[model samples]
Target chain A: MVTINKPATKLNEPSKPQKSSSPSLTAFVKAFKNSIVLIVFILLWELAPQLGFVEKTFLPPFSEVVQAWWELLVTGELWRHFEASILRSLFGFLLALALAIPLGLIIGWYPLARDLLTPILELFRNTAALALLPVFILILGIGEVSKISIVLFACTWPVLLNTISAVKNVDPLLIKSARSMNISSFKLFYKVILPASVPTIFTGIRMAGTGAILVLIAAEMIGAKAGLGYFITYSQYNFLIPEMYAGIITISLLGLLINYGLSSAERYFSRWKQ
Target chain B: MDKIKFERVTKKFLVRDEYKKGAQREFTAIKDIEFSVKEGEFITLVGPSGCGKSTLLDLLTGLTQPTKGRILIDGREITGPGLDRGIVFQQYALFPWKTARGNIEFGLEAKGIPKSERKEKAEYYLDLVGLKNFADRYPHELSGGMKQRVAIARSLAFNPDVLLMDEPFAALDAQTRETLQTELLRIWKKTGKTIIFITHGIDEAVYLGERVVVLSANPGTVKKIVDIPLKDRLEDADIKSNPAFINARREVWNLLHEPEFQGAHI
Candidate 1:
């Protein structure tokens, strides 16, 4: 009965864990290693055309795109197109906001109305704003109205849905608490529910702003005569690849700028929340 | 005249959907409950949690319509919630977007107090609740105790005829709860306002009430009403260690623990 198991291995042997002093540093090193592919991509783009690996006529180098950007800047044509696109986007976006906000508030506050209209709105929201391009072109004849309609369709959903959910998601406790204080009905909505939902509402506006700009450019590209989208299509057709690429760059920059502006607005309004 | 009265109030509830319309089961929430509060009285409704002390308060505040009876406040029938009765909820329900001063001035502004007078009233209560430095801070920025204090200040700013509170300090930590209770007493004294406080906490009921009314489990009904007359003796801190405090808590505890409270969730 005194049979004792001998040491299967070194009983007190300390198993060492792999040394990792800083996981964050390791992650940074790993990311840098992974970015080598991107570096190679840039290098290939820079060197391929110069080495005649591809036809220079069809595809200009990045340098040529930059040079085209400089020429456009000097002539102020770039700024003009940029201004036109921004103005259309702004007008359409504001118009849609004015329409959607009150409508959405009414639907959200009344359960019966929301239930009645939910299916119809679902159908319209699912129909792509771009798909209405042909209908808009026929009715508005490719003028400001057509372009504005496209932008308006793209921006409406985010603001509307956000408003509805913002109203719907107000805490029951807040309502009960307010009623106990004898707050008037109008006061309850403005003072309690609206303020409670401001953060979520801002999220919607930011999304709508970005979406309107993105869709506006796409619409403009298809039918516009003078905006940046129009200029890109014209340059591409006329064998001006560098200017075409320059237009692409400008579109991305405009999107980034709009996103930055809306984000700042959200932060400003919600500063007190945190 | 009584400040508030509920004459033979009976509340019923449907137990099931009964969509067939012909058949349904109804449960009694409270049956023939009758009580009243006097002017300048501090009445604490103490019972096991489901005893409908809060429902009674809601009736007095006109937030609910009694199914079979009537409620009178200052001999007038209660129709709906009005500015005359101010309530503090279990959760400190301050407006999150506004600063402490803004919340305090809210009622007065609605009642058309001038800008200077509003500022004066807000500042006065801010000082009373010891939140003068926190005047510009929003509710989200303040601690739980501070928010509750601001709520009290806002409620008192209107000089409500009756103060109705439903477990106002239940959400606070023990220290904060005790502090608020004492503050409430101080405010009650300074303003001479009638207070109807509801609680399941036996110790708090004894400490805060001029009279403690106890109720049995559902179908809730009043079982005992103990008139403390202990306010004079409770002036000192060490007075809590006196026999009366323990005796009151024990009496309420005894009334609450009768076989019904063992199964109730509250």
Candidate 2:
């Protein structure tokens, strides 16, 4: 059966060709073009305080923030906090991935499992993860466990839902064609279903990666002592504005790094899709 | 002996009527389809849309069960899909994750063939389809016709006794379709495998088939089986202008244009 009745003309069109230039140089130019707005914003931030558009003590100059960031980096204080935050988010994200993917596969593959679990999933998905912070803290104690649990809770929904949808919606024709070859069920799942679902699953994974960091920061701000969130809060209370700015900058850079890494990994896995 | 047999096969689907409060109703997709395909014969199933041409192929592949009767391959009643029959879909269902060679190797992999042997076999089929140099290319990197060629190679690599195709060239442009049709005839002549090709194109059916099985719609059943007299003219450069080709095409076109089959045009 022709389940997807899209016109042949649409399918026949070739994907837009990539620029035929030296790869590294082309990538560098592309990156520079993409970051033009960010570069201008940074330049403006540096000039704003230098030109006395804002008080140095209140907002701090970009150079001062960088100096504070460098001092923290040299003393290994910033590294500790950065490392701590990374480890927690990574651990939580990994745990959620481990639990959700297989479970999503099961739910997607079997209609009964989907029916049994969908209501509970939908309920948890709609309820904000932060709103459950106090409950998590009370149940798991105000420690790394609660912070990690919060991150796990925040990341699980997107991964699970996206995986379910992806697995459920694998092109029926692909499966039909495979079945025509008498492929075993196990082989079909691995060879056909799993690869077909990877692109959508990666979308979920990227979202969960970002969500893990966002929720972890919020969780850290509540009770943690050595995370970027805690560091910024502590600096703000002590009127160390430059240190606060440094923490914010570190978070932004960390976010950018995580996103870049995930995208690269996504590209590697989905090279076939292109 | 017949290589494939459909023994009074019928398919019925219970489709829900949305306007009638979701009432379930029986839709007879095809009724009492009885035909036999001889070994090494190239047969074309020509009909309008909804005539169960695809459903017949599905039954032969054992992807869908015949609700009423049995389908047999080589005197054995087929229970489910086996390695004996390979199908090429119009959509060119090559695995997006696999290269041309890899897609061709898929059936071999399922049959538990050794990796090295699978590679050699894939290469052989790639060359047969004139895509030997494109074996390493992904499906997306190839043009529409090339992709379909890879799909044909993939089915052929398995070395099945029968090749079932469902409008395999309906998606291609006219030139590509004609080229593939000629290539298909070459492959059929070389391999001597039984081919049951389905198409809505009357001219294609007349050009490719020794016998064109014309199916009628609305509880689809055999309408007319037109035996083309111009089988030797398949390779003619001006075959479309040949009187015999024109006669066969007109004959099939008239059968399809019969009053009951009017609205069934694709």
Candidate 3:
């Protein structure tokens, strides 16, 4: 009983009168227990180079990487790269979302639209975004347009496909029930279909979020004056290994933040799903 | 005058023949389904599994058009579903995203009722179905019986004169089914709304309806319409235990079991 209460205390406020102080203590212990593996991995990362398990130049200690990250942060160099990547991914992801959702809804709702577009969609969906980067660079040039377009291309498929399936898969009984009240087609779509498809559409959006980050990183690595991907490549060229690790760490943290944001949004939208 | 009428309604479906590749066959679900309901009357439809009981309700709701003949409501032809009628399906059909009150407000909103009036009417029906306390609860948060109650409140909220229910309590346990039956009768008396309920349960048909319309299968059509005359209905006696109730149940049972209909035990 106490063990069950301990895990739940992590979520709930400290309101129980039986052991107010113990709840916090239990929460801390639970959190510690959960992250013990992560703590050990971090410890090993810090110690391996110092203990001569690996060469210092190849893999610096975790502290040295953290120090490098702080130095880059203070110099404001990291922020410039971070800002460039953030803007590109954000614009690309938003564009894909704006275009894909409406198109997907139409295609899913109307069989004629689905039949007309599905063949073309499937042809492009199978073509990798990275493979099209060179063509995009040649057509759009090695500018912000090209980098953003690559992210847009990669992100579009997940959102579009997921949205299409989401709309198509809404329970037919819901539609029947709504229509029985003489609801208009527009009302049926907005009131019934849209809300019913939310959770599935969110699944697509999250996948697109991840794709936006990864594809933008790859595009930046290919050609960019400033961005986290470019910074890492530049650091590698100059043998600034710690700084390279720092850029990699920044990308990882950014991915975590985006994933965390999407999951929270999904939770809020689907709160009724038990 | 009859509140609702079904004039020689026949529904047909085209299906691919299982044995013959790419071949289509015509199947008749119900033939010449003719009936009439007086204003404020309560009627129950009972039939075996393939008797097109659900198909009949769908036609009445205007979810589907009859292949032949037509349905009428208030002496006007029903070209499509209108606010004059409401339907309750076997599944609660409450929107998971909407709370009990929100679901009740849906049809009213569609009917262009003002927000305040919609809220008032939703509250009234929520209270009518004994789900006032659960007005804020989502469909998934409610129990099976509670969800069905919310569904009833939602349909009733729009003030439709005719309510068509397709086995609305078929999914509940016997206790909840009986309880909802009593509640339904009480609401019918209070609101004076005409109801056409479809069910497989003979006891349920006898208990709920003023008249039970028993149907035969294999191209479904009406077989018998049994009138139930109870001296003490729900208010004064255990109606199910009454002799009239037993006799009505047995009569419907005998009609369904007359060797022509298949799966009559259902």
RMSD of each: 10.5, 6.1, 3.2
* TM-score of predicted chain B versus true chain B for each candidate: 0.93, 0.97, 0.97
lDDT of 2 at A122: 85
Q: Sort every candidate by TM-score, greatest first.
A: 3, 2, 1
Using Cα atoms, each model's DockQ against the true complex is 0.25, 0.58, 0.64
Docking class of 3: medium
> Candidate 3: deviation at residue A159, Å?
0.5
**Where in model 2 is the C-alpha error above 4 Å?**
A1-35, B263-266
Ranking by lDDT: 2, 3, 1
TM-score of each: 0.86, 0.94, 0.95
Tens digits of per-residue lDDT, candidate 3, A1-274, equal 3434433452214546665456666777878999999999999999999999999998999999999999999999999999999999999999999999998998899978887887888778788889999999999998999998988898888888888889989999999999998989998999999999999999999999998998899999999999999999999999999999999999999999999999999999998787
lDDT of 1 by residue, A1-274 (tens): 2333433452224555536556566566778899989788767776788789997777677788789998998999999898999999999888888988778877888999888877878777778888888888998988998999888887888888888878888887778767766778898888787777888878878888987877887788888878888888888889788898889889889888888988888888787776
In angstroms, the error of model 2 at B156 is: 0.5
Which regions in candidate 3 have their CA more than 4 angstroms from the true location? A1-21, B262-266
Residue-by-residue lDDT tens digits, candidate 2, A1-274: 2133323443346655557545566667768999999899888889998899988788887889999999999999999999999999999999999999998998999988888888899898888898999999999997899999999888899999989989989999999999999998999999999999999999999999999999988888888888999998999999989999999999999899999999999999999887
Better of 2 and 3 by TM-score: 3
What order do candidates take by DockQ, descending?
3, 2, 1
For candidate 1, lDDT tens digit of each residue in B183-243?
8898888889999898888888888898898887687788888877575533787757778
What TM-score quantifies how close candidate 1 is to the native fold? 0.86
